[model samples]
Target: MSPSTSVLDMLSITPPGWGGVLITGAFATLFISFGAYLFGMTLGLFGALGKLSGIRPLQYALNLYTTIVRAVPELILIVSLYYAGTDGLNRILALADFGPIEVNGLVAAIAVLGFVQGAYMTEVLRGAILAIPVGQVEAAKAFGMRPGLRFRRIVLPALIPNALPGFANLWMSVIKDSALIAVVGYQELALAARVAASNTKQYMVFFLAAAALYLVITIVSNMLFSALEGYFRRGQRPVA
Candidate 1:
């Protein structure tokens, strides 16, 4: 058969094609990235707040958390956290006389990646919060604004403008990091491509397709983040 027909046959979604496998894997990747990104944001927000909360103990604890997570290699963190979390949960259950329960891979993957993402996000958000002018917060306080009110009315708005670029970077990082899930035997885009290549003995074709899919995701994400950044940066004078 010609190379064109061979490529088509290998990629075809019908009987022999692995296209469906790749598409499903891509969806899984997106789901994991989205879930982890949101979870990380929640953790980072609290982590950032804790770091700035003036409670020495809380600040120390958060510092330890972020420092360790950022220091470790991400692959090791993912594998270690994935097993430790599941095993620890089962151990807790076992103490209560319950059978070991299987954790959902999706949930486990999200939790692990989110945990790692939170550390970097903590610094990003903390820096952003720090960048806000103290005078604005002080003025709000002088106007009888409660701490909560000041945060909502003044701090958050200012924080986003500074935080957004970092957030965008994190989002892209998470998307790529989701591929690491495959190392723990979870079948995402990379793994799916591996399977297809192994079956067809056409490594280049399948791997290239996977790369193309990833590129597409990155392109779309960049567009979305650009739009969001534009929205947040509106009314500000352009930087020289």
Candidate 2:
């Protein structure tokens, strides 16, 4: 931008303006967060089940996994996992005489964030599963329902209400956590804002724009989660 360029011109969507860049970055942020959250939820499901499965070794392993992940700073985890994961994959490929391939940035970002998210999600789900009434499962068993059927019909439905709030929180967390991907050079909203600020020398303007985008995301997410919670809690008695 020239010295004479107005802030409005710099933010315009047309030529030489970075509004388009910022919007694209915002979409990228959403994509990464959504993908990571889904991946984490999948991992958390098996993790929660294993933790509760009465297998000593499995429980210990999961315990260690959750403990280490939760204890470490998220930024440290992101940097470590981001490099370690791709390097580990290349190492395995090298053993077979295969050429090392560059992992896609989007995939790495999702995997790293998802791995971190899985630990918290596991505990959230475990607690929700435990909150389910034991009598419901026993009653299903008495009616000759198989374990899988029992979980599907009884446990899942019951747990959703209990877990929805935690799920909402995790969703919010991952959206913000996606910003850490910028440290690794992937161009999410934060990175986009930084690039714009650096080039235009309007740090405050670009950063506040990015902050507004994040606030919009948070507000929309809250409305969506509220609806989801209402849907899941249908027919349930309100807590007195």
Candidate 3:
């Protein structure tokens, strides 16, 4: 038996078919991270806008939201929210006379991710927005441009250059943090590794494979973000 064939046969013998489970787990991890990033972007945008509005009460509330979320450890938040979220939702459904429903770990993880990461993203976007020249915004307004038009034409274009790098960093963080979802029973890459190890009693093998898989993802993400940043920076000169 060839070495390659032996490896394949061993994988096939596993309950999840090592190849299938690992591949699926990778996708799941990516999907969870990506979905949460998108969600966080939306939440962060609102938070940034609220902060920038300069309303003292609103700013204080938004700041408090970010402060509490950022201070807490992500793993504790995920596990706590998973249990509390399930109970809270189920009770609401029961009260509504609807059938009880269970929240999937993936769903709970996404919520936790959005709550936590969105806080950080808010500051990133806020700083990006602040980096834009206030003079340009005033000039736009002076040009008879409406508030919406000024934002669409000047504000968005100006801040995007600053925001992209921050977004890339946030994206990478999300990918790594998705592993924590395993603690909540989301069965992502790390959880899959644990299961595969337990089933085959080949702890070293499965762990090494999981590590390789995560490394591949991180590498691919870095390359992708580099390409994106390059594309965005095509015509730009660096500031001194």
Residue runs of model 3 more than 4 Å from their true location after superposition: 1-8, 11-17, 94-99
- Local distance difference test, each candidate: 0.94, 0.95, 0.86
In Å, residue 208's CA in model 2 sits off its true spot by 0.3
Q: Candidates ranked by lDDT, best first?
A: 2, 1, 3
Candidate 1 minimal-lDDT segment of 10 residues: 231-240
* TM-score rank order: 1, 2, 3
lDDT (Cα, tens digit) per residue for candidate 3, span 1-240: 786765565467355458668768888999899889988999999999999998999999999989987898888877777788888999999999999887777777888787778898999999999999889999998899997898899998888888998999999899888999988778888898888878878777778888898999989999998898778777999644
For candidate 2, give the lDDT.
Answer: 0.95
The true-versus-predicted C-alpha distance at residue 18 of model 1, in Å, is 0.9
| Deviation from native of the Cα of residue 17 in model 1, angstroms | 0.8
Question: Candidate 3: lDDT of 174?
Answer: 92
Stretches of candidate 1 above 4 Å error?
none
Which scores higher on lDDT, 2 or 3?
Answer: 2
Worst 10 residues of 2 by lDDT: 1-10
- Candidate 2: where are CA atoms >4 Å away? 1-5
Pick the winner on TM-score between candidates 1 and 2. 1
lDDT of 3: 0.86
